[model samples]
Target chain A: MMIPLESFHLAEPVLAYLDPGTGSIILQAVVGIVLGAVFAIRMFWSRICMTVSGIFGKGGMEKDGEDETEHSG
Target chain B: MRRSTPAERRLPSSFRDPSGFLFQRDGTLFRQVNEVYREDFQRLMRPDGLYDRLVSDRLLVRHEEAPKEFVDPELGFTVIAPERVPFISYPYEWSFSQLKDAALLTLQIQRLAMEHDMSLKDCSAYNIQFLEGRPVLIDTLSLERYEEGKPWVAYRQFCQHFLAPLALMSYQDVRLSQLLRVYIDGVPLDLASKLLPSRTKWKFSLLTHLHLHAGSQKRHADDAATGKSAKARDAKISKFRLTALVDNLQSTVRKLEWKPAGTEWGDYYADTNYDDQSMAKKQELVARLAAKAKPQSVWDLGANNGHFSRIAAEAAGVAAVAFDIDPVAVEKNYRQIQSDQRKDILPLVLDLTNPSPSLGWHHRERDSLAERGPADLVMGLALIHHLAISNNLPFDHLARFFHDVGKSVILEFVPKSDSQVRKLLATREDIFPDYHEEGFEASFGQWFEIEERISIEGSERTLYFLRRKD
Candidate 1:
């Protein structure tokens, strides 16, 4: 509910600063540095995977759909 | 230094930011810049600055520097009088698309701030308010001079305020946005992390920002500058990395969508008890009443998709707030407002049984619904039965409520004979013995002077227009 800012130990707890929730700041740094590279790599890999899947996935699409043997009927 | 009189009241929410605080002097709102933030204030107000760009683009609420006399020499750098927003609706009140649009607006402002050699120091959702049917940043002091290698102070806020709630609403339920009322700062990341389904773990953005980021907050929550904490505290982020982070957030926000479907109120107008002819007649009557009232502002209670509120606002050429119980209904109304570029009506999610109360420090930070009202007209088109019969609210209480929020009231009285009222009575015992036409008039007569009453042509319903008795 209503969390008192003091309950969460902020880096600047000693001062009268609007505690930017220390954990959030650190995570931002971590995500900014690490996730950026991971995301870029993931994007490039996904593109390649999509290209490969685009060719093979058509067969899977046909398998998933109901059989359309209208000419035989 | 002149002492701040009773008339010169500082806003409670304004005390959080050290740069500036908003205060009202003689009924006019003004943001006073502290001496400490003089440089940052100068940078923000400079020629071709972020303020000019944002105001020009209608992304930010416009303001003007107040006269010299308004300044408090002891603690003030300057004072700015901002253009007032007609209605102050919260994030909890917004629909999925409304919240999403506000999110995108925040991100856009952030990027623009960076481009202008500044950064949004505080990304609280409260900073954004809808003006003229568009979300605009109301807080002028949210931005500060950009420092190299400094991580965004408001990233956690942006996630908690905008990203977390948006994700939960999209993945789980639209009602999840209401969690903002309980958690004031935004939905707690850990709570959001717990509430969100496991399937969200596979979504790259949600995984990194919400789940992993939540873990990071929990990990460093109590830790000081020791090993992992030290590394986190002293971490340096490149501009490129920051840009990438913003890009990720932008893409994530842009991708999230809620189609406003499957709710009971989705097709309310079509499935209502009224047939085409009766509905048309009701609309014509409402338009006539609105014109007759000559309202500058109207409040439509239980306005499902704002059917009648739109008529009232359009016919009177006035602004109106359409409040409804279901988020879906409000969302549909909001989407229509966006598509039509309608500027007169603001649709919000509101349960009349327990409307939004006064909130924050001494309950003064956000004004309650009643505090924002006494609207020129309050139209309760086809809603009295639901309150009196379904909710078991007394007619006197309803009358007082109507009188409190509105100067004049236009109420539609749905009789026991009405099919809709019969449907309500069919499910439960009809305990409302005094729920009749004369009973309604007598009860409301205590607070209002009955001016006119017109019965609908095809329906067993009467529309009464009454002016509040002083």
Candidate 2:
């Protein structure tokens, strides 16, 4: 038999969220923060490396940029 | 107080869904859709086209609308009669590949639902059942119209039920799948995270879904208990992002693979003492006995790789459930069924000594192995000695247990002198003085009437066909 939401004190009328327990909510928050940071760092790391390399070799960097844009296009 | 008939009985496990619940009437199973789910149900059946596509694709069990008179009209919007599965199996009873396939099926159903502007309300592994040799979703009311900018609510459940256990089985040990039995809602993310190897954190999917997921759950739980508001953490995810999440999960599940090889029972046939002639003779005896009984369903106990269960299914035209204790053997058997598209045999991992038990709400939501059966026939080939000697189960107890689960039993008695029995006895004392053929018959004769007994030509083992005495 299916358990009723009222029994778990989770019946919020017309609300979209199905309360996934306090533990689950907390866990998702922590996980989101860590994953969000990782994603941010990875995305910026590539751009930062490209900028640093461009400072060292302007002509080579320009050629690489054209190749990248061509591949992306 | 009034006596409730079996037909009026509502399945306890089905009550979790306010949308609908399964009940039986006149020996037929029916689902009662509640009024609270009327709008979603209408959408599923009408403009959404979710029900039609799923039923046609054979991804969901087909159902027919039943008269309202079939159930209490006040509580039900409508009643539907779904095609009954021959046998119901749980996730814990499933082999690694079986669980993986079920997970993939759930994701595929979700993807399909999105195309119809619907989404699955929940992703419980119990909603999927192996029918016609493949996993099919049985919960008709689990689909609901999708709302934009809402996160996939069932994300944590899917990870807990499917991803966590799959990761543990793939990374830690295949036997860890037993944790599903203890954690009915799926393995606790925190526990699974701790049990998993540190190296798993390097894998992006594992890190995000399990390791980070576990940490978030713990922190949220602690904060909430302290009366702290964590509403800011509830991020609004676009439909595109949700679809991408589903795709990522599919890739993660697909990449997690387990090769069934090098296990003890997986290589049983190669090391068996029985020669080709004896093995063929044994198969013939089992097939002939199964044909004589003409059973509608058969359970092959300790069916290593289902070598003999196939004989019963093919020879008797009966649906067979092949059960073995070893995951590798069951994996190989399931792989064979998938490859051949065989519909008659279902291979599951089961340890007869500690079989699947009744669990969930008041221990009634799910059925125990014994509750699911009394199969028409049970084949126990070369398995008696293991229970008798290795596990210290007596013949009388084994006979009674078999009689309780089957009307007819086809068993093989391996003498103490047999190589396999000898190997079992090698590790322990020969305290079983009544382990001989005569002792075996006397004990089993209490519950079953012996019909036929045949000795293999080249082996010291004997096969008996017996019918339970009414």
Model 2: residues with Cα > 4 Å off, grouped in runs: A1-13, A16-18, A21-73, B1-6, B222-234, B260-268
Summarize candidate 2's per-residue lDDT along B1-470 as a digit string, tens digits: 12347558777798676777888877889998988787778878873388988888788999998888535566678989999999999999899888998888889888888887788888899999999788889999888767665556677889989999999999989899999999988999999999999999999889888998887777666665565644633545556556656766777888897764555433544656689899889888888999998999899999998988999998899789999998878888888888788889899999999998899889998999899989999999989999999999988999899999999999999999998998898878899999999999998899999999899899999999999998
TM-scores, all models, native as reference = 0.88, 0.87
Candidate 1 residues B70-151, lDDT tens each? 5466777788899998888998888888888888888888888888778888788899988888888999888877766777
The interface root-mean-square deviations, each candidate in sequence, come to: 11.6, 8.9
Q: Least accurate stretch of 10 residues (summed lDDT) in model 2 chain B?
A: B260-269
Measured against the true two-chain complex, the DockQ scores of the candidates, in the order shown, are 0.20, 0.11
The numbered model that scores best in DockQ is 1
Name the lDDT value of residue B30 in candidate 2: 93
Measured with DockQ on alpha carbons, how good is candidate 2?
Answer: 0.11
Clashing pairs in 1: none
Docking quality band of candidate 1, CAPRI definitions? incorrect
